[model samples]
Target chain A: MMLKKVVVCGVGLIGGSFALALKAAGAVGEVVGLGRTQASLAAAQQRGVIDRIASDWADALHDADLVFLAMPVGQVASVLVSMAPYLSSTTVITDGGSTKVDVALAARQALGAQCAQFVPGHPIAGAEKSGVAAARADLFYQKRVVLTPLAENTEAHIALVEHVWQACGAEVSRLDAEDHDRVFAAVSHLPHFLAFALVHEFAQRADSAQLFGFAAGGFRDFTRIASSHPEMWRDICLANRSALLVELDAYMVELMRARVLLAGADAEGLQAMFDTARTRRDAWLDGLTPPGE
Target chain B: MMLKKVVVCGVGLIGGSFALALKAAGAVGEVVGLGRTQASLAAAQQRGVIDRIASDWADALHDADLVFLAMPVGQVASVLVSMAPYLSSTTVITDGGSTKVDVALAARQALGAQCAQFVPGHPIAGAEKSGVAAARADLFYQKRVVLTPLAENTEAHIALVEHVWQACGAEVSRLDAEDHDRVFAAVSHLPHFLAFALVHEFAQRADSAQLFGFAAGGFRDFTRIASSHPEMWRDICLANRSALLVELDAYMVELMRARVLLAGADAEGLQAMFDTARTRRDAWLDGLTPPGE
Candidate 1:
């Protein structure tokens, strides 16, 4: 299915990559960029990520087949409110936010009855670098794009979002908005928070320089996610606070168990836990698809 | 200052890599291997990592200018006791154990007066894959090798060990045994335990497959260290229990701080903490030397 005109609200990594992928796949007729800054929109257009820059939401959404809100979670509510008047009844909408429930709530409050056309999605692909300049057409190829379909979403609207993601070479999956937030809160958000906490712990130490100087490969890999955008992570942690708190509490229990094993000098127990973790991680990695497949 | 004979006890990744590096540098004449299994020693010899497999400590230490105990921290005490009778005052002995304080204590208790000949050291270089087959001549090149010299250790013996690591192209640093344990407990051991705990937590869940399925780059990198050798980590953690427990407590406090911020929905505080972490990690990466330099 071809989209006549796709309006991307934020022309950064996710939005720009989506526009580029749809354009490359010959799935979209025209990609129009709308963002906070004209300079960023102009940059996206110059990079061929967008056909043109829209002066306003009405201009961007006029006759638009799809409108993608690809911004941080904190920005989603205001953007949804701003575009609600311009949103055409015929136009379907989706998002690339990290958290789903909050975005769904915002869409419901802003779009009201028109919320039936909105699909909340999160593309599980990212790099240490971001922004329009880091965008690529193949970013989502073989990647997972999870669509948390709200009860209000029509079958046709959901299918349209799924078809567009498939055209971008993504394997699309569906889940309830609450389930999506809870799953990610466990797998993604908790790890990010742990990493950030570790780095913050080290940085605040009196002998931080000495500790960092001694850190090697294990430390580097374990804390790599700690270098993620602070504002984005803050928004995600706050948006999914309840589920994340549950995960954090559960993880603390696990850590406390580990601590007991260590404090008591139980080599057998510690080895058992480590063995399980290593075996599970190795198996997971083995089952993963090779890159660029 | 070239070594006439160097006996490597384990002939695994660390031992084999040391032998290969010394050979590559033309700094040693003969590399002898000694281990629990003849099969592993034979494999190391076949890979050209060792000149021959030693029949016993008597044979391995005979005329050996250097002896390297590259076995796990758990085995260091028994190995030191086994080799003490064969060790010569002229031979400078060192180790590649992760923990230093315990190893130094083991040397002192096992070797008695001969403890002066032993230097406790840790080469902070490793890969997820281990064993002799994974060894490389350049594994320690441009890496950090920290030595914790005992008061019983002669300056000459310490220098000899340091010189050999330098010959292997590693930058050597010195710290007190207590300080070495504390530093690594924070930087390396804590991170490994956290990764292991996180992965184990996910694996034990009823919906683990679903959680692992949705885990992306952040989770992958954050838990990469979870795939490390269980036995090795078990030995390290048990050997460095005191310091590791202290680190764990400090980290728990940090996690609690983050938890409070999330639970309170304190976006500004959470963002500030994340900002500090990212800024510090970025600075650390920026200051790090590029690979293969």
Candidate 2:
């Protein structure tokens, strides 16, 4: 097989989906799931996301060709620290965290001598659904997977990780960790925060029920991301705090300008701003293939 | 026929769709379109949205039993003033403006004694697409249509307008003009403004192309309204300025609080806010029938 044994840490949506995709592509002989909870690991096994469960990092790393860390950002550091002693010199490690800088630093501190083997990555694919039950073999099909390799990583290590992603039908691209954090903070994290904030504001109003009853498809689509897993978003917001703050500031300034335009009944100014955004968004959407294509 | 003749002003997506729906339900004997431009009127007629085009409001109102003022909020006032001189005492008039208060005042000032026949309405249905080309007979099927009747409007006039909407497969409800504006300001106008502002901000960034390239489906859906017709939104924002400004202020306060929470790494606070929002949004979604159902 392309890989003799693959261990997927935290076998929920991301980790479980990756293992299933790799297995479907015949890229690995055996896939073992590693998680603290037996219930989740059992569920992952039942879903065929992993062939078996690993009791601990020692068991998970034993003769494992690759390890994919797909846990919450908050837990990635601790897991890496615990797995450091058991990691084989030949084992290549990669991650699927949304935020990369923190995870990269975690690897540097936790892996120490073996840091070069750990390639930090983020698969830019997901659904609103979560957990092992939501995992699918073709979750990564035609999706983008971004790798933010550490300075210590060797060319061979990066290639091996890229090969695994390609086999799963994902297109691979490389960026520095900081750049990845900034880009995602603006495009993904900031939008989630805004959606959540808008929903929260509405929920706190006295006429929330009446207002929500009047809401149609537009409000539903705009706030869909607010339905994301709470703890996962919380961790992402905290982990990528600096970059997210900058984006939020930029968004706030734009909002303030719009408020002024509306207050003054400046139709020309408002239309110009909207026209620019509409033109840009339409052009951007035209270039994208629909999801799963 | 339920109505002898119907005249629809503006003849864009909203107007065209309403005319088509009424025609499909066999509620009107003849449907005439009125617009400032001949091109849009010709297009609407070619698409069978209307039976014929009127060179002026006077010509359209010649023998009409009902008239639909389905123009932008900014144009609604001027159209009402122009049509007032030709409006027959028996003609029941209504509008599909996003804001109700301004339209109510406009009808009062423009129609004079005929104001009793004018019913202000806001139909809560639309697509990102616009124009007569995007019109569909079922556009208002299962959609909510809120009517904010003026004090001068006779019960018979309101019922006639409601009957027409019911025949078109829309659920009709009543609200005060002021209340309708407040509710829609929070739910629709504010959200559209926020989306436009976000997209506008991103477009102005130096790395805009790269950043937009990384945006996913969630971003696309959340900002879909940003691609709405610019002049249309500008008019709505201005027409409902007072109510919109109140909602915008509340939204700004919420955004500021979120910024503080993120800056301070308040995970517990952030999670609590997100959880509340997620629970509410999920509940709201559960109540909605999927689109086109």
Candidate 3:
């Protein structure tokens, strides 16, 4: 198979790693990197994520057969709009955004007929660390990469995007944009919110001020997500507010029950609450209970 | 200083690691292992954790200058009562129980005047993997091992317990038994409950029924504690039910507030909720936050 010329915007962990994965798979002939920081672009270039460094966004996009939006989720719409005027008819565009519906709609509004060439994609993969320094060539291997295509999605464009992900060793799944948003809101967003809320609650206590040195392995594991980039999570929570609200309601119902059981000295009730959760989690996590519980 | 003879009852992660650490630090002349399981006793014996594996508990208690109960929280009281007849008048008995108040009170009831020699200890260090195989000489390095010295605690016994943990490379902090219960309940128990509960809730979803194939690094880190021994956590929740209840109640308050904000589409409230937590965690984690947030 002939290699496509691919340009990756943003040289951070997600983008840089994707760029390396494509290079490792030999799916791209030449990779071009665009970044706001000269140091990051230089670092990515030195690491061979890109065959050549681009001086500007135009330099990166001009001859590219495929363009990847690996920047922040908030930056996706604006960058897509800016790239449309220069995009070739043969060029295909895709994004590595966490939230898809907003990005997909933004592409429809901004690119119009060009939306047919844009495949809205999100690879549910990343490390806790950031920056190009942490990039790995096999980062996306065996990970799930979801694409949300609109009614106007061209067959050729969808196949091209799937080919790109498959070459990167990802298992591709196609789903409606709205369903993608709701599922992720439950699986991802609500978890992040709970992590932040729980950590904030602990940090407020007088006991935390003095005796928190006693918090061991479990405490650290559960609250590690609370230490994520605030601006990123803030944007996500705001963008996915509707679906996240539903999950928050469901969770509160359970929390309230636990509260009641505890207050009533209902050891039986507490045991019931704990046992149900314990048995279910144990079964699910051990692969005995099928997913979606 | 001559090496102290220490008898560690229950040879597993905590006790076995404690023995390795003491031996490494040249803090012990002889270490004795007392356990109900023959395999664990054999492992501890082979690993040099105990100079001898006790087949009879009373005979093991005969020669020890100090006794450390490293058994499960639920079994601490019964063990104390069983060992009371074997304890020497001059020996100090301390336990490494996670929950302190009940164990301290139990020591008082079971040991009577001998209770003054008993100091309740909890070292805030562990790995998800347990058993003698997980034991390490540096397991407690730079970690806190809190000694909850009750009003019944004597100066000599407390000092000896503090010296033991310090020799194991732990920074020792002293607290009242009840306060120790309250603080750990918030930091450790509540987080474990939530992880178990969330996993159970998600298990019921049809989408999750397929497989948890899309789990990311964040999900793994957050739920790593969910894989802990269920019996251990069950005993903890049961032993420290009151304090765990208080923390769970406090947590639901925040969870509800978050739900309301998400439901009302109050983006500002949502941002503030996340921001307060983000800023608070960042500041506290980065070691820049004021004493109270």
- Superposed by TM-score, candidate 2 places the C-alpha of residue B13 at a distance from the truth, in angstroms, of 1.1
**What clash pairs does model 1 have?**
none
CA displacement after TM-score superposition, residue B108 of candidate 2 (Å): 0.1
How much is the lDDT of residue A33 in candidate 2?
91
RMSD (Å) of each candidate, 1 decimal? 1.7, 1.8, 4.4
Ranking by DockQ: 1, 2, 3
**What is candidate 1's CA lDDT for residue A259?**
97
TM-score of 3: 0.86
lDDT of 2: 0.91
Q: Which of 1 and 3 is ahead in TM-score?
A: 1
Estimate candidate 1's RMSD in Å. Answer: 1.7
Candidate 3 reaches a DockQ of: 0.41
Q: List, residue by residue over B2-70, the lDDT tens digit for candidate 2.
A: 898999998989999999999999999999999888999999998889999987878888988999988
DockQ of 1: 0.90
Instruction: Between candidates 2 and 3, name the one with more favorable TM-score.
Output: 2
lDDT of 1 by residue, B1-293 (tens): 69999999998999999999999999999999999878888999999999998888999889999999998899999999989888887888999999999999999999999899999999999887779999999999999999999998888888999999999989998999899999999999999999999999999999999998888888888888888889999999999999999999999999998899999999999999999999999999988984446
* Model 1 clash number: 0
Give me the runs in candidate 3 sitting further than 4 Å from their true place: A1-4, A24-26, A29-60, A131-138, A204-208, A211-214, A264-293, B1-5, B36-48, B51-57, B266-269, B272-293
